[model samples]
Target chain A: MKKGRLERFLESDVDNILYWVSIFVVVLTAIIYVAQIWFVNYTGRYDLLECRLKTMTGINCPGCGGTRALKSLFKGDIFSSLYYNAFATYGAIIYILFFVTQTLERITKGKIKGIKFKMVYLWIAIGVLVIQYLLKFIIPGYKI
Target chain B: MDNNFNEEPNYTGEVVGEPKESGKAKASMICGIIGVVLCVIGCFCCIGYAGVPLAIIAIVMAMMSKNETDGELTQQAKIGLICGIAALLVLVLGFVIGFVIGFASAFTGA
Candidate 1:
């Protein structure tokens, strides 16, 4: 009798590896989350590379200080990240939500629903990209 | 249009292939192409770090296209995804390692 695909997959050592890898990712994300919270609470500052770099370089990238924004966001400092870059904060939230939902579904062997990539959303993203690039280049006060 | 009553209808053995590819798949291929283009631009531009993540996403999406019924679209997506990932990784690593070294220099005066 031919073994079913599920039975074969379950029997494979790849399943065991995948299980451990997933655990590692979850634990690492959790640890990073905690560290981010601690850092934000202790420092009372959302950024480590903010004005210092901005001062040196006369230009800013659209994603300037986005890493710090991500850390602040993970620390539940929504307002802080928003202050840094509202779009980046929103993007991070969206990315995290999608990642978590899909990861959970995959782990549970649940069917993941397809997200319709709307034209509006794409246009919005493109607009944000252009605006951010312009702010970085044209508006010196908005650097970082 | 001819209407026949009670005559044994001849079955044409010609198998019409799958219906033309869905719009969704075509859109994904477009997105994958865009991702590759953005990643390449990011490599030359200062935003090399962002390229890696975007490229990775593109590669995953392209690979996911394997389940799609369209062969040509799948092939294009795969190529774009691979190129994007490779270029992005090289640029990101270069910058990341450079930053690490720069940071270490701040700690140890040499």
Candidate 2:
């Protein structure tokens, strides 16, 4: 039986799927970031992304302040980004560097070394995320 | 009969057991399932970007499972790959829809 297009695509090689999707996701993210910057510049409003949890519970979620952190990071305000969300600020930087190296390695056909993903990376994120979330509760004065 | 049962019946030391799956395949499957769960939660909740890292991890792990062959993947690896892709798609959709709606509303001075 002849396979349909969707079936064929779904059954395609894992590497090819990952490779293409990674590129697409990264590029889409970059475009969205650029558009966000433009929007902020044009509108003079940072109300685009509201913390739904804060609005409902009058408290911060684990990911609270992420949007502001991203905004600051995109604007190159590292200190402010860290103030908003320390882990997010550094995570974005690391992710960008990782992707850049990955692209270079691919383009250069492995001539350039790429950053390898490690389980420690996930562990670090988890630790930082939890600690920061805890700090937000323990120290009311902390900006987090 | 007891001695025959106890003594090795000229048994070659070949271990007769189920083949162990690769570490990468197992990791991929674990990460993929977690990624899907997180991504789904993220889509419905405020933490819409939560599962992006897990999805990437799943993808990387699945890719690493490839042996000498470029395209070949085990069953677990395939599950991981599919789930990772699905998670990514779901995350992107949630984020993009949110941004688009927000952008449209703000642009209309609403």
Candidate 3:
């Protein structure tokens, strides 16, 4: 069967695509983090970006505090990350493990089989999010 | 593509020429489904950006699956890839629209 250009690219350029995408993410993260620092220094009273849902609805959404959690994670403060948003904190840990495992499998050329990414794992993660969501409302004096 | 990746028959007990799916492909499919679902959940409020990451994950997993396995996406993985792309486009579009609105409001003092 003949292949189209897009098909050929997808088949042959998987590594290149992943590489560029990862590079883009890293660069974007760096830019956003730097901008955030500058904004904080300049404003001193407000964050540069605000959560739309919280601002509009006066209630925390499912992913509230995710940005703070990510910032704390980037700063290597795991406890603060978890305090900000347990879901994002745990999700980052899981993603790091997944990424490391993927890199190892590629480096080893599949000689060492890493643990399979199971559907059950995602379900468990969702379960944790649901628990946290309920607790945010149930517990008094809990930060959003 | 290594046809012998599957050492045993699947739950259906069907031993075909194609082996069972690698974890990456399965993850791709799962992430794609999640991405689309999240995008469909109304890309307003806090949910607007939720699907973007999942879509990226889906596409990445599909690419990795192709790289490690058959050099071609599995049927499910291809579906995942398409869904991921669709979700990404929708979410990004919503983000752009939101940004434009915010900018206009700030300029107009509204």
Candidate 4:
């Protein structure tokens, strides 16, 4: 007939759903990345969807080489990772940090704190966007 | 019929205030701007994929405004949501049909 602290907290919170959802997505993306790398190595080919996309479209989408970039990073091939998608390696770092922050905040129920690096993050994001676009135009034979 | 029996109860929960309406409105406004920007970009650059999701998100955020307690932003949310939804529908339908027909033709060699 008695309830615990965890149950009481859950009853009071609406944000738990969002928090859990964020964790799920982060975990799922990581799993998918692993599977994709295995498939790529086994087949000696990237995704057929992306291959066809590049052949037909003649220009790369922002997320075109993100998977390859992640794969390369995991394999410790820094130059290959950059070649695949420079922004993506950095993106994975940010994603992991985001996941950790959200998880900590959710578990603490309001006591957890966050860093104040907004301006720096904004500048870095803008820089990456510009660099990605420039590299698309400048770098030859590095097509995504 | 059970609505009469289940009359709405007055607020009696912990007094944690809801998220600010301005924050929600700012989010909706950003989504709308991004949607329009994507649509334009897609049109000019022939990459409609980027714009479709943006438009959808904008519209959903806009529709959420109806439930918002922010009086100042209600109209903005409604308009933005409606426009975004409309744009997304048009673009998605147009692309789907085009792709279907093209694929059919390619397969049939006609």
Candidate 5:
């Protein structure tokens, strides 16, 4: 039986499509984050996305200061970034890894190694969120 | 003692087990799991936006991989696809609920 065009495409080009889509997503995210940082730098206002939890409950959520953290990190303020949101540093590292992996996979025609999200990484991320949440309470005058 | 049959084993066109699973299927499954995890975390934290994009990517990858594979591997891809879609749904629902609540509060001047 002869395969249809869609079937042929699914069998042959799907891998390439996945690879390219991943690359596009990572690139787009990086661009957006950079633009957000630029906006914050110029406006001195961190109002990208409002925190619904904070607004409603008058309390800091685990990710309340994430945008500020990213902005501070971009501005070379490591201490301030950590004070704002520790996960920003780890998120930045993950973003860099995603960008490199996707770029390398494309350049090497999928010959280079591909990366997988490990369970350990997820656990570490969750742990960091918890730790940051706890620190927000323990540290005096810790503003979200 | 009649075991003197010396015939060569015919190994031509024999039925083998299912085709070897594609690496893409495995990748799809992993991505889906990660997406679901991120979405769950995002629901509590403030990272729902980040998870939504990842969930979309995972769903796409799973669909592509599902098209390329079959049998047990297809099952794996299906799991990935379901998880990815569920994560996206969770994120979208959260956003909608949050928006409605915020709007109601503002409208009521609460």
Candidate 6:
């Protein structure tokens, strides 16, 4: 049977799709990071999205300090990043891995293999987030 | 050699010989990609509420595709399923925690 146009395009253009998607992700992240810097500088506040959980419940969510953590990491404050949200470090690492894989795939014309442990990596990320939440709840003075 | 040249082309047989690829698998892969992208956007922009529905949709499509696919295509569906589930879990967990805490504080007057 003759393949549909969409199917043919998907099968044939996967490399190009992956390459462009990677670029898009990287560019978006960069833009967000830059915007965050400007927002913090002008507003004198780190968090743009006020945590609803914190505000309504007076308790931190699992991802409460993730933004501040990323901001600190981007600003090169490693200790502060960990202090605000340890999960941010893991998130950053995963993002970096994704960026590297995508960039490499684009450069190598799909010859260079990208990380294939798609589900495993995702599960690991989820596990880390859960662990971070548990640590914050169980350990005194361990803030998330 | 002359007998082979005399044979008629079996167009119907040719069409039937090739297996039809399932659209479900393709839809599953597309939904998964969209779900992951939206999750990233939601996380970065702090608008996770907007991403939850899309993630759920992605998970549903991926599961539907998973049953129809095999091998590498199955792997793609699995990736989508995992991504969608992860995004949904994160959002749900946050809301659940927030509500629980809110109720606890209300009862305790703390």
Per DockQ, the best of the predicted structures is 5
Going through the candidates in order, their DockQ values are: 0.09, 0.11, 0.15, 0.09, 0.21, 0.12
Which candidate model has the greater TM-score, 1 or 2?
2
Model 3 CA deviation exceeding 4 Å by range: A1-48, A74-77, A107-113, B1-28, B34-110
Question: For candidate 1, lDDT tens digit of each residue in A38-130?
Answer: 887798875532433343345454556665677799899988776566556765665455456656766677686423334455456557656
Query: lDDT of all the models against the reference?
Result: 0.52, 0.68, 0.67, 0.55, 0.67, 0.61
TM-score computed on alpha carbons, candidate 2: 0.53
lDDT of 2 by residue, B1-110 (tens): 35543334436865545445565665676568657755764654444454677688788878877862366898888988998999999878867876786689799987
Q: Estimate candidate 4's alpha-carbon lDDT, on a 0 to 1 scale.
A: 0.55
Lowest lDDT 10-mer window, candidate 4 chain A? A9-18
- Tens digits of per-residue lDDT for model 3, A1-144: 999975454444333333334445446655665676677789884533555556656787667777788889999999888777787777677767766766777689988654555567667777766787788899899885
TM-score of chain B of 3: 0.68
What is the DockQ score of candidate 3, to 2 decimals?
0.15
Clashing pairs in 5: none
Give the fraction of reference interface contacts each candidate recovers: 0.00, 0.02, 0.11, 0.00, 0.15, 0.04
lDDT of 5 by residue, A57-84 (tens): 7888677787788889889998888888
Best prediction by lDDT: 2
lDDT of 5 by residue, B1-110 (tens): 56433433347844455656655565566567657756765665544455667677667667667545543347767777788898888777776887788699899998
lDDT of 4 by residue, B13-107 (tens): 43444344433333444445445544533432232344455566566555555545544446556656765776676556656755786699799
List pairs with backbone clashes in candidate 3.
none
Report interface Cα RMSD per prediction: 10.5, 6.1, 5.8, 8.2, 4.8, 6.0
Residue A29, candidate 5: C-alpha displacement in angstroms: 3.4
Better of 2 and 4 by DockQ: 2
Write the number of the candidate with greater lDDT, choosing between 5 and 6.
Answer: 5
